[model samples]
Target: MKTLTRKEFIEQVGIGAAVLFVAACAGSCKKTAQGPSSVNFTIDVSTGNLATNGGFLVQNGVVVARTSSGSFIAVAATCTHQGGTLNYSSGSNQFVCPLHGAIFSSTGAAVSGPTSTAVQKYNTTLTGNSLRVYS
Candidate 1:
């Protein structure tokens, strides 16, 4: 059997490391596009996070939020930056991407980015306990 010398082993390790690094970066930086198109859905806001001001929930690829002022907003649930799942911050009335600190307004405009594109926004309406989200 052949055995590698120290120089040969180091070179092999370096090459392997470079390959792994490239793969990791490619996967990590890949933008994830998710959410509904021609969006139309209903959620009962009488319970769960949607029931209260400054609360939120994600359903059917939409992030729905109730602002501190008791109004509702809906936006795509995936971050435009790298497909990170978005979280609604009612305190700031913004959608935030956990992966890269991307900030988006409740209307789905990109406030900051590793992404230049804005997430699509959906229209929201409330009737009794039924909240409808649509494009």
Candidate 2:
């Protein structure tokens, strides 16, 4: 193999770095381009899993929870305090962030913790066996 001169080596390294930077930027831009927005989806609750009270599921960055009365509620799954992902607690009827211990009520209201801003809530409707969650 032919050895690269000092100047040729620097040029090749610079080109490789530029290519890598462009590739990284392209991948990140694709993610940021899709800003947060309302999402609508249909789920079949006839299976009896989500149909029961206290059932919950997270999909497409949103959390869908079934209340004790069998009512469905949807909200953003990310904590408002530090953008930490939240998990639903069936026993406490709230969403808890493991990162900072932030807690949000079932209605997405910031109940107790460092965050005072409530998470974005979506409206949910049940028609027969179909459940739709939307903004």
lDDT of each: 0.87, 0.80
What TM-score would candidate 2 get against the native? 0.66
* lDDT of each residue in 1-135, candidate 1, tens digit only: 889999999999999999999998986874433467878999999999999999999888889999999999999998876789899987789999999999998778888868766788889999999999998
- Best candidate according to TM-score: 1
Question: Candidate 2, residues 41-128: lDDT per residue as tens digits?
Answer: 9888877558788888778888888877778887888888878887877788888889999898878888899987778788788999
Point to the candidate with the largest lDDT. 1
TM of each candidate vs. truth: 0.73, 0.66
In model 1, which regions exceed 4 Å deviation?
Answer: 1-35
